[model samples]
Target: MELLPRRPDRLFPVLLRWMAIGMLSLLAHRLVFLFMYVFQAVRLEPELQDGAVASVLKALFVGLRFDLATLTIWIGPFALLLSLTAALYALPAARLRYRLLNSLFFHAQWIWLLWLHLVSVASTYNFSVNGKHLGWEFAAYFRDLPVLLAGSFVKDPVPTTMLALFIPVWVGAGFFVDRRLSVHAGAADGHPNPGRKALLTALLSPLVVLIAAVVLFRGGLQQNPLRPGDAMSESSPFLNNLKITGTYLIVHDLSDRGDFKTFYPPEENTAFVQRMLNDGRPFVDPQYPLLRRMEARRRMPGRFATIAGPGLPGRPDRQPNFVVLLMESWSAKFLESHGYSAEVAPNFNRLAHQGVLFENFYASGGRSANGLFSILTGIPDRAGRTILRSSRIFNRFGSLPLLLKKKGYQTLFVHGGDLHFDNLDTGLPHLGFDHLAGMKEMEDSGLYSRRWTMGFHDEDMYDMLLRKTDELYAGAPERPFFAMAFTSNNHHPFGLPDPSFAIFPESDPEAAFKNSYHYSDYALGKLIDIIRTKPYFQNTIILIVADHSHHANLDYLQDREIPLLVYAPSFFQPERRTDIAGQLDLLPTLLSLSGGDSPYAAMGRDLTVPAERPFAFFAGGSNTDIIGMMRDGFIYYHYLRSSQSILLKGTHPVDMRDMQAEQPQLAVELDAMTKHYYQFARSLEKENRIWPESISE
Candidate 1:
């Protein structure tokens, strides 16, 4: 009677209904995540902290006032869409269990979206400042692969874990809606119903298509993403244009490390693709040999000077433990007139008082990596990439440190971020360093930012640095050592550390710069104190320089323009140097200062004494390079592409084209210098050798 109340039939339909609902919800969830990826392409990295969410919720208590209306402008549309989607997802389902399954599906989508946001932040925020393509620098990360695969193996693990976590959340949300909102809305149909059969058939083909699309798209974007040679070939006709534009972009991106006003359209983007492609062309000609190198001499003066070698580093009678501190984002203009204000480094000011301060020292490049390359190798970044990226250029880079090590100086490098991020770990050892230290190398990894949104707070870096100083210099036969310290406090995301947290700024950019400088100074003071305790206090040489200009604050000026100050406890204190010098001169100058033999093919003359040449710094591109040269109490700004030159007198701009054109011989001489610089760089890259014995001034 009553059809025997067939329980098996009822149970079968109920199960089918749940299975169908789960599949549809999963599909919808994945669709939302795809749009999130599109947002990242334009550099909108959304922050997702539980704390930030809490702050927004608390603002609700502030009342529905007109003041809150302004907050809606930016996120209003997206917020509305998300709300509508959430409401749709919360609709009453046919079965209780099915609703719960659907909720878990939606939550998994959120986990996927979060992973994309993290990557968008990581790549853009981290600053290396080399005028080269960042995409090809990594051993991992193909443009075509799933973003998670583009990163390391570990990068995808957390997202996978989060997806697992979301299943429970999704199931619970579905159950809550079903029991509370849809209990009465359900029909006589159970979990296993005809509805489920239809749902499965509807999605099966599309689902297969979706997966195929992901694979096909990735394949189209990058045929093979991980291989280096893949970057050498242009991906499209558009990419050829991207290469030519990159040369212009390098001046804007790598040098000043600032967004230029797109002097030409694809300024930064073009430069972002130059993976050792010297402005759409390779730096080294394929057939070039080490013996017949330095051929890029006729192109430009900057290239010429860059190719010429600084012959034989002078012998170090007693090469003291040298510590070259490359302070990040520093300005040289502050030291020009009244000296850096309390707004900057007081200790550095004092150090300048005790040391030989290059009043007119200029940085060859506008980036940290670029300036470092110029300083260490005494060659410009004409290789179209960073020295770290092209380790195969020579068996050893410059050999300045390796030679010093032979002279008995232990060498070490210290940086704020992970050294491997830019391949510093792989490349620096070849640069002749005995050791490398970065945030990862430190034992006390501070709770700076797990994400490092702004990167490791400079104060944390300074603290970590001090703790590791002894370990870095441990048991080194008591000979002089060369320690390179890179400071990052003044860098990005611009958040300051608390006084309780570390000795950082009280809260303004001016204060932040001062805080960072102070922290670095204190660390220097501590290192100096250690030197005082050791026997090398009087014999040690400390060179304080900036890797690049403080691009964040243009008003601070002197960005590519920098100061070079050398401090020795009692060795030599010339006090002030009016000689013109660029970062390319650093190696030769230091070698001369330490009395070491000059290396082969260093274009820069020694600046430890007066430099006979004008202060020249080149911004590269086929056109539109901002070349600033100094001569006779005047700074000349020349547009290399357009052949425009200006000599600003005192605080006023003056047309110096005719005046500069007067120096035909000087122009010819500078052209030769630029040629030499390129020749040397090409030699290293093509021949994989450096000739120190056959070098000449």
Candidate 2:
């Protein structure tokens, strides 16, 4: 008798075979990725050759985790669909027609897998060019696809051609492995009966596999997910980069792509942030002529010695509490402290007299984000971009808050405006701020105002600040707290907490801006008054500084000079410093006063220490293309948009002469230094060396 043909119930095994085949293909791609990375590392960072085999093994091991994450993301949905289809086909009433459907899906999966592997390889070439993996920044090229397509050949013809050639070869290799392992629906070993039990097993298996896939996708259940930063080893950046999977690097940075343009040589940029180097180490990068000169001058005898001794009665036995009041638009133009009239900021003038005042301090850039980045990270703002908000380097910088936290300080960042503004909400946390309170929290406490679009009025912020301070001190009285409070009332529209609070209210808008400045100062005075009454006042250090200056145009200063006051009655003596400083100097100065030797990096110097060549750098305007450098009783401005340099005679700035003709060397030096600073900053960002790699541990 002819036996009944056994039902083809091997769909589950075929699905399993497909999964195993896909994994093998993915593994092959990963090995190629590792090879490309190692090749690049040896070229860029020659030092990586030492223990090359060992480092590669370590990177490969680390890369496996990233690869698993990537594979799960790429294959998950398709796996689920295939598994479900197999289960459905294995039912008691299953049909042979299902084989056609399975074949269609199998082909689709093959095509998708091929595309993903090719794209992964292509991303490495891009990374090789810019030392960056694909991300939202890379996706941005799609908007200008024609330009990217056309320029790919013009800008990098050889690499583009090689990439084009390599893709097909890579995909072919994947296809070969896939074909060897794949088990299609045809000619499967027939089984007797695939009843409900067998069908249920096939269906439920996908869910079980899916759960495992999810665990792999997240790279284990850690508080922080595996990021590109985790790839960094103790080895060089290139070696660290070797461990970075293209997918992980790209996915992490896919959120926001702000205005970011890199305009610096990688080596020069790397050497520019010399803060990680020991003090005795020489920073002699010829590419950075300005830094070289500054380094040489600093090496002079008595140059780094204290310029002004501590004026306090006694130094603190422990680290003092730091209260940084980053006032909004607190321009020196409205303060008598910076030679402006006392009418607009009498309270500020009084505080200046009672504190250490930086007389010629300039803002790093026009925006608050620039000022915040400079003050916190001690890095100058990139010329044309918000470096803090736009770069992956945000997490890398040896931040003030992070260092302070190491020194047992509770780091807190309070802003009257929404912290989400300019991506500050996400950025500040990465910079190591432990607690962030913004407009919503401020409004919940009834400290917010609807009069201004910015957020809370100055007085309201101060009131809320006092309450927060009390709560913090009560929670941890012994632990020194480093609180940075950002005010927003003095921003655009220039509305005060109350009209009566304005000391210099005028009918004119500029005059009203001055009045708002006065109101901000008054609010500061209230906070100070409340602090003095509290027991924490004696050991507290209050640093009141501007996020950036208003366009008062009172002087011909090439940059916008803002008032910087360090009121540490227990540590600093009341003295006005004429040394040119900027927001970059703030963190270094504070660290010096705290007497903390935390291994940190900063672009600015400690003003309390003497330096031979003191200069203030600033770049502002619509595109932030106007770069300016102030030094040696003269100011130079380089307008990138116009490619013109202007040299002014004195502080008043009226006498403008052709920089090339009048002070050719000075103008050239300023222009080169500005470019060098920005380039170095950008390079640091690209290398992911903004913060020391060992910070997390």
Candidate 3:
């Protein structure tokens, strides 16, 4: 270096070669997905007929467009890097360092390609289970990959273990291909001449390539890019799916369809939807179609005449304050009211006896997001989709907070954990909450828990809630208040501040869960005690419900069973209702209890009234598409993918897989119920009328 450093070689030529090779490797990666889909199709089919052959050919053609778009987006950043490398390598100096950089980028491309193929392969299985492409809406909830992987292994260990073994072979093959193609990437070359002709060509070449990449990224000058539905020309949904690659589908979903709304044709299904909306109910006008029926209900003709009146007929004129407590992981599994271990939740038992408890209540899905969305939106959770914290589509929904705000109520959402954990922070405000507070707010108030992840203990949260409620109501005594509080101390890595609160020893997970459950119950008792001492105690109503069951067996009633306790001693009767109910029923019930006369669109009927359909619909286990209908004393399950159904008698510790064979006739009932729920959801999305305030053009 003391002497003049040796001039490096020309850079543009090497960069060009690298870009071409990367494009080829990306094409190869796409073929990997194609082959996997074909492999699954062939295995599922005994022989490939002419129809299948035609389907495959068309799929390949349609798939290319999607693949091209994916490649374009994937290589945009890489292209920029290559352009910089090209200019630097063209310089007489720094050529060696640039060559090394090129090689590293080459290796990085192969690693990324390997990851893409792996995800593509795994998605085939996911599709098989749910009969839907795995999209970004579903992927957004993959926050805890380790836990998800472990749960998958526990569900079916053999398949996961085999996939793990094959991953190395796939990655190694990609590495080998990268090595073969990039052999000349680091080779030294003559320095580029500084002539105007050479400089112009170098600049123009990358510019042209970049322009082409941009066009491809926007998907070939079309008004809109290719979507998942674009590949649905085939008669068979399964064959139609073969035209879509998993990676392309996920990318397309992320780009468009923010809420993951279904594409089912609502106009054609108007009559079907009309039947579902009424179901021979006395309150509904059977002559009207879906939207017309909703309009009719909004009128609430002649004194809100119905079989069941709004909650507490004696106090209908008084608008009571509402507080909904979404207890974490508080499945009926741990509730003594549901005949669990008697020592588990003494306070809940006492509370349930003093109020109305739904004996057949169930959560609509396994996740907390499902319960939260259904409870607040009054809509059934869509199968195989997550809406909470999904920034693209949260504000689209009609929320309870928005409805209550119209009625002069102060709306608040409180959680002991980080509100931003699942995108709740953005979503809650959009839902019409005036105040959204979480762990940060709790800590600021000097209420912090050392044993908890987000600091504030369940006891502290409840205590703070009492104070906050006082302040909110005090601000405007004329305005009623509605608040939702979520507790997290009973969740995984469950713990309690006071060891003496545990009735059972923390020797195992179930024991530890019970201990934490008891402690939460103790905190709830404290909150209730404070409420009882308040001046507005008689005019206040508290609703206790679980987000979802955690440790319950996936059989009939046990899996979806959750407690729904309505505590309003001055108004509602202290009797237990045995009709089937779900999280979706809470909103309409709350509105009725509030004695609000305004009409609203709700998928669930008012639970304060008698249940029109004595069946609760819920999705459980690993597959969300497996819809379950719990009615009478049996649970019927319908697998939407294969149109398979199984009936399991209501009992504890029964295996769902080992249940009785398909009931073809009863399967129709389950199908109708599932379709009805989705039809309503799709109709709302199509009309863009989830809330009464939403204007539909």
Candidate 4:
């Protein structure tokens, strides 16, 4: 066939390309879908949803495989646009005919799209699921997006469907477009060029084949990390399926949570305690059980030196209205602006000047829940698992809200996301919250006009919180106020809510986190403005601290740590103290600052006014592998798996002796106290107690 791009032959190639693309797309979607579904079914027993097996089957089949309904929905608009635009490309005046052009264009489009999906799926699945970034070594697994989808298969299936759709359109569109476009009449005068050049353009066909192969591989790897209620383990049925089918060849260690231990005293197998304080050797005779138990139960002096040595006399003047804004993903030492203002938060700098900003406050855990537990409860997380999540298993925590409620304070717990998503409803109110307001509760309220997420905008939430503050102060003159506010926009997939007031710039981040930071600042500003206008500003002591500081799965905020901003009236001069602290110290700090003896002795010291052992602990659970940190700056990050440690100059490692010493000390004074807290909380949870005079813990 001596062709110069004839129409009949061209159409066949276009159709072929589309078929291959579709097969490849749907195949990959099914692989990831089935993988996640199967993983959850075998590894976890999710209490959130009803039928695990059915949901898994639905996802494995309808959700992942041949989501024709969604495929059409996504492509329908693009198809319309392409068809309209093809009119121009198909016009006779155009030199390029649709016949030879469409296939190539579609192939090129698919390549770009596959890369985008790769990034998306990878970012989600491969993420560390830890607190945030660490230095630069974050969860850069090019595979997080797929992993986090384990249990939350039903949240947004569009991404999976889109991946399926993208593969085919990308593959087929180019070929089809080219073939159709080639029909334009390029007369024999100029277009009389021989057949091979235009027709043999399929020489580039092998490139497409390689791309198709990668797409197939990509699909097979995606799995959900949040396996509904169950944490996934190595023995997942999905992994077996992958092995049987020979679909996916590699399985990555998606999370550091696994290798780490969560229970008290770390894992028995690990040598962390032995290595840290024991000169990298076991304290016991290696195989002695009794000796190991003896070694493990010991305690060391937690506060080596002065956390905060007793010093200044009490401020004779009334305390200021403390507003502690714990910026998400923030660290006290990390913000470059603290060193050189050219690169970091200007608003923080301003706030630091306005109030006393403690420079060395560490987060209690690598998670928001961890920070909240520490700040509100003052008790560090048990050896593993967050106190809030582990409450059903262990003891429920006592919140600052509850502690303050006894002192005549009406408490409010507010956040921009769902209160019950992570059992905040079960936990928060148990801690004595008078009101729990989250995105679900923001319905029809002006506080949340925009809705990318179900939660109200931070600005809107702030507005609502301020109004509530006003109402409480105006009407309820008898009770003091305690409010815990959580900002959400700066969270992962950090897309901006409003660009006009963008505080942080985003040349580009997968998520525009800078914008979220800027927004957080604005929310704080709004809060401050409200405080200025109200009388509560003068009397209300607001404590601002981060829920936890992490950027997505990697917590880079370790340096700056969480900030402790206690804002009150000018009566309390902004006295900057070098008392190092953590979220655990918030309660005792507040209680001490209030000059009232606590109902129950606090694990956290009176950090607000400064006391001995100024630093608080960032007790890492299994997720981060880091263990206790002392206020005197002794941090112990037990790499639970390897047992290898890198002791920064400031912190010391917790050895067998330390554990031996600390455990008994914990047992002696704190154990009974801690147990009482749980007993009290259980009673409160059962009795429908709302800020009762005393819960008894």
Candidate 5:
């Protein structure tokens, strides 16, 4: 009996150990994902109650599947290496080398695990503030790492410290686990017929593991691979978002750039988009579908009527001086006028009473650059990389600033941050501005504060605006000016130079944000006071609007809703309009108000005139390829990848229930319209046809 004892199979133990290590790594990923889920659930406690619990649990299960897929894909190469090492272990001469390579591979796997953990942690904060996971857009922040890190540490030290400490602990834990695994692996016995058994095991084991990995990586035996859209739950966007892991998003984003796959013919897309934007008018050109001749809708009767401009024909009124204040992260939800209990925007509220406020106005996208692009070009943000950051930025457009410049107006663009930060320094000038000013200019004036990481405080930016306007006015008082001032203090890290503006206690969750909002409002009031004392105040038309809403716990539609105010007591009547409008409407609306009959191409209509049926189009930011349309008191969301659509009723409290089931036809129609809108814009930009070829660069 003692002579009949058989030796252990060497291949089986190696394969088992690999599987065990893989499972442990997967468990680690699951733990981090659960932590994020708990964080989100706690933050959105009020919203996720009752039946939402089951939906949340279902989403967690879906998330586990995605985590499995992500892990399998990531460890596929390591699995191959393990199989190779196992085959070599059959030879006594290669045994030592196999052990060394296996150990190295194990450590490499730990490094990858650490990376996944860090990205998941970062995504938690991103979701908390931006209502999204980490995607390719986050890569842009790496360019300004110093400022980003400084701001994070200054604003939220506790989380920053925790993240810093996580690295060493993770590494130490990896070492401990490796030591235990090493001991166990060493205690295993070798096979009787080493060479033949190891070779056979290597061949068969790799084939089995490869098939299993491929199945898991694809998320099942389904015809198609898993997609972010597959995780979407019609009942709860929060649950839908929860089902998507950061690793999946980052990898998906890198692999797919949301390129125009052309769902419909170019002609079909053009016709639909033209019909939507034509406003019952005829198209000017066969080649240019969006181009139309805009006629002035208003006549000015004032002292400035004596001044002449090309757009103002016989009436002979000077084009109104334009001062657009592109406020940063100014959510309508933070304003008293918008039913917010807080008096965080008293100054804006006061101005709203003296201006034509568009209550149903929404942003084109969820970023500053998106707002700027839409406001200037009258086009909604297209899917994929932002136009400002893409090579297509050089494409000529019928931008309002450029059109105004052609009408003998002096154009200037000023920002509170580094103009170079978002390529604004290069892109703004290329868009149309004759002059550009930013942090460098402010610093030269000695008003810049080093304490502010992004830029100087909002008050300092306001002062710079005043100074810049004065210079423009003094240089050519006869010429109307088109000046844009982009603010920065209301953004993340929410820093304030003056502590007096702190309205909430430090114990409050959004204390820093509330304080910054109050400070920006204070600056707005001061700027208005100074403007009222100037002579140009009588002729200047000032617009106060947000780049986008502050990303908070809300439905998708509500997140895009922002405040739009047109202030000029002498020109526009003080009225509150309930018509749906967006940042895209800014250019055409402003052109019509100023008595300009410029030939332009735009996707938006003049909001000054009432539309029998008005709608707004929005792109789900860089994180997702979702196109949305708000029409007929309902919002339609079309998820491109999974061909999924959601229709929601109402705005304030959007009914999260899927109305698409009851109204399938309407959903299909709206989905087609939204798709056409996005594809049309994308095609035009790519073809460099947004503007007529006659317009020279």
Candidate 6:
């Protein structure tokens, strides 16, 4: 007897048809991703542009795999149901009922395809605006949908119009495609196979589809499932982003939210962190692991020590006033002092020669919020969450502003943008800011004529800083002040009020960015000029640093590297320090320089004091979960999710080659050290132990 029926089964043709639709849907996703890649490539750096063709091909190949995985997830259940319905069609009695059900499933696939295309278009627009695919920010954007749409129309009308038109047009095309592909499922043959054979085929077909679906959903038979980081083969961030589908990013980021798991015991993590921070000194209290009483080491005798200034209060020593300029997107790579060919920050370069400049300084994380959280609180930015936006913002801390308040210094936070953005208005005050100012305050002043998309121009913000400083001194001239002004003009979309500052031609890809940098530098020069004329200028110390680097096609180390200048010519001598430091060190270093001996909790050490084992810990990568440590002429990167680590040698032009295999022992040591810091940070934040209100408790 024949092993199977001579005629083809009805289920076979229906299953093949469904497979064809699934493949086409996947292909459509690939094409949309290709469009995003090309759109982003328009702004690629010269080096990245040189290898664009090869990178695009590689990214597309990787993107295709992710697309398959995403599509399988989206259509797996429907496909299984269709398979069972088709198998049932092979039965003579149930043919009519199964055909209707099969048709319904096919239409459902068509609707899902339409929705996928719409999401793809929306993600393309999102990439253009934010430089990445849709992620957790989708929820924030959705909540602000009305404002976002209004801004999109006003600021980016071209892409907005195209995306708006795409919806209806794609929906019409979907309808047309569905109608054209409405062919009926194959009818059952009069000569049916034996009932046993039909039932066996029906059972076996769904099982086969289930197995295939499982394999595709996992992307292969690998020991581990595919991840967004797996697509990170290229050094260019844009290329890595292109290689992963939006569906994967959204799901990955959403799932990773609020999941701060502790890998080690609290005691183990606390002990490691305490040892690293104590510098061979004893902890002030056993109840608080990170708390320690630090000595006030004077770097150099200033005029206030001998002159008995107004803020001296019968004591010869008076605290120095602080002016911290948290510059926006001021990447070290764009400064002439940092080896850039262009003089994007001439004022910064001129001032760097008058004070101590940290040549190897890096930001604690990528975002402005990360820099603020790290620099103010002396705590490293936690992976997978921005502390400012999280529930931990309510936690007490030994923040710079709070410590300064204890020293009889007036603390203020000013920004050129809305203080409400990033929850700064509430978080800063909760962290002990005596006063807060933003765009509304500047606008209320009626200071200028022009404004940019973000808010006031850099010059306007600098002017406001001057005014705010004067007000603080007028109210309490005897009290030293700590005022932080965060700039916004150098941010994305690179808006500038004047075009004369453009360093390159409009045709140049980075022309807008160069112009914004130039204008912001000019504003800095203006601020310094006004400050120099003030009587208290000699007693004030200015700290200039970037919130984070601009988003460029750069490797991990290059992206976080930023300039840190402590400018007080009358106090500290001019010197360039090559020591490794990060944003976390700012609070302790500033507090040390301010000459305060109070007990405080800080994860970072004072940069003014030489470190026995110098290292800078940072949170980075596309998802911000990668922990990196730079020490002993080597950089170690550990991906927390995958437990993948790499060791690279050198700093300038960090050699991307993995040295882990050759230096296995060093890698293991550095990896353990890095994880200790990560775990301790999470533990401290979770337990509210960074700085308790009362150490005795």
lDDT of 3 by residue, 1-697 (tens): 0001112223344444534544554445335434545666666655444466676677767766766666665555555555556556455575556546655765575566556545644554455554544566246535643454465456546655555445355445545654433434422233444456445544554576677677866558764444444555343445555656566667655643423434346554555554555534333322223222121122122222233344333432257789999998888877776667667788899898888888878888778887888899876665555555322233255567877787678998888887756567656776778897888888777655453754578888887788788888788777788999999888877777877876775566477777888888888988898899987788788999999877544345566788999887876668878788888877766776666454455666676556456666675444666666666566777665555767776556555653454455555665666655565564554344565334331
- Give the TM-score comparing model 2 with the true structure, all chains together: 0.62
- lDDT head-to-head 2 vs 6, winner: 6
Clash list (residue pairs), candidate 6: none
TM-score of each predicted structure versus truth: 0.51, 0.62, 0.62, 0.49, 0.64, 0.63
Over 4 Å off, model 6? 1-259, 302-317, 621-623, 695-697
TM-score quality measure for candidate 3: 0.62
Clashes of each: 60, 5, 1, 94, 0, 0
Q: Report the C-alpha lDDT of model 6 over 196-267, residue by residue, as the tens digit.
A: 655666667778878887787667987546655456434465776677766666766566554355667878
Q: Give the best candidate by lDDT.
A: 6
Q: Tens digit of lDDT per residue, candidate 5, span 550-605?
A: 78664566687889988888866678889899999888877776675678888887
C-alpha lDDT values of all predictions? 0.45, 0.64, 0.63, 0.46, 0.71, 0.73
Query: Model 3, stretches more than 4 Å misplaced?
Result: 1-72, 76-265, 268-270, 279-317, 449-451, 506-509, 552-556, 620-622, 640-644, 651-662, 686-689, 692-697
Off by over 4 Å in 2: 1-121, 124-317, 391-393, 446-451, 502-509, 552-559, 621-623, 695-697
Q: What is the lDDT of residue 543 in candidate 6?
A: 92
Instruction: Kindly report which residue stretches of model 1 are placed more than 4 angstroms away from their true locations once superposed.
Output: 1-317, 336-340, 390-396, 443-474, 499-530, 553-557, 620-697
What is candidate 6's CA lDDT for residue 572? 75
Between candidates 5 and 6, the lDDT winner: 6
Give per-residue lDDT, candidate 5, residue 303.
16
Residue 90 lDDT, candidate 3, scale 0-100: 52
lDDT of 3 at 391: 24
